[model samples]
Target: MIESARNLDALKRRLASLDRVVRTRHAHFPFGHAPLDRMLGGGLARGRVHEFFACEGGEAAATGLSLILARLAGPQATTLWLRPSAAARQGVPYGPGLTALGVDPAHLLIGVMQDEGMLLRAAVEALRSPALGALLLEIRGRAPQLDLTASRRLTLAAEQSGVTALLLRLDADPTASAADTRWRVGAAPSVPLPGNAPGMSAFDLTLLRHRGGRDGVAWRLIWDNERGLFGDGRDERDDHGRQGEGREGGAPLSRASLSFPAVRPAADRAA
Candidate 1:
């Protein structure tokens, strides 16, 4: 059994190496924020997996970030989201919720897997599929199947298929991962509104790990779901729908507002 395991490990390493050498046209998935893009060395590279973790009471924030990225796949593109059966029992993604989050329900397919192993398997297969524009896997806690080796396998599949993969790790501590970037997300206090109404959701994001990039940088960002973009409370659009260029006093200055630029799907780009 030991020898067989060793052989399998070696085979996986070889496959990973081979996958790295396969030449494919990779495009940048920019966050539309100048400072964040600069920190990311332009932007998150496609054909790679990004890992996101949430602190206590921040599950919604982390999922929001992932969904924002998934929206970058464009309206016509297909996105696959996988979650464990346990998570499905508590919070299954529905069309209304996703629509409220600025994601088109028709473009997303949600899968509830029986266990971590099945979830990872489905994620890997979806990552390898050329038809999918993006893949998202959400896990609530630590799972043995999500170790470094398994992560590398998923990474290799993503690279080969040129599909973007996002892993949302909820209520978990940081650990070794093969993902290109890792972020820790926490809910931030929202701005107060008139009539004691609730304001937009905000998130405090920390760059925990990034391949070939600096870490420890943090930002408090607000998501404009209606616009399908992120904003830093700089200014509001005028009545004509044009955003004004001005910073708020005593407000945290966001480097730049993110604009949802059109990024063609991988197959379309390859064509």
Candidate 2:
């Protein structure tokens, strides 16, 4: 009888492992942009690390990317936001701000740590928890612990738990990473609404890197916070009624149109 019980336990463990693999294999979130989604081979892979960095005058855009993903995780899902205490003190997410960003304040849990080591340890632990829907780690410039090895470890943990991890590197140049996708987000001026009201926040998102896809692609999208989706600037066109600059008929701009180099800043144009 004891032998039979042991075998049953082992079988249960195997089933659980198989379940994780199956879920991870099929999990994905579509960005709702056809060209970008096509380039992504469907959509963003869940259970993987996606890095978002800011370009010149684009810090808010990077945070917007993370928040949009969190919204995609489902309404009931909770997000674990881990950052250094210093960063938190600088500007923590408040209830009103989260509402404006279309994220539920109640669904967010902010964890403030002392330094990089503590923050990363907390991130790993939080990522391994299956209850958390997503993990967001804020790295100031290049946090020492965010090196390739550590990123891989976090990626594995996310894969095992089927949780999505986003690394937000503020004011940092893009570098090689173990993340599945890398994006450089830049802010775009919003379209003016009636009565000169400010419209939805827009972003110029450049795909800097991907594991098995093309890079140096860019898209101009506006965030519809209420719906939690990015919109192509279809309603707003140039004076000629054409789509807009740097894009073709609301489609993502190709690498050639981006002009700037991916993975690093371009050299001085005048130099």
lDDT of 1 by residue, 47-161 (tens): 8989989888777778877877877643346666777776665644544445656777666666667778877877786676666667778887777779999999999998888
Q: Write the per-residue lDDT of candidate 2 for residues 5-110, one digit (tens) a residue.
A: 0122332342233222223345678766665677788788888999999887666567766876765753456676776776655554544445666777666666
Off by over 4 Å in 1: 1-26, 192-197, 232-271
| Residue 159 in candidate 1, Cα distance off native in Å | 0.7
Q: Which of the numbered candidates is closest to the native, going by highest lDDT?
A: 1
RMSD value for candidate 1: 11.6
Q: After superposition, how far is residue 42 of candidate 1 from its true place, in Å?
A: 2.1
Q: Per-model C-alpha lDDT, please?
A: 0.66, 0.65
Tell me the spans in candidate 2 whose CA falls farther than 4 Å from its real position: 1-26, 232-271
Q: TM-scores of the models, in the given order?
A: 0.74, 0.76
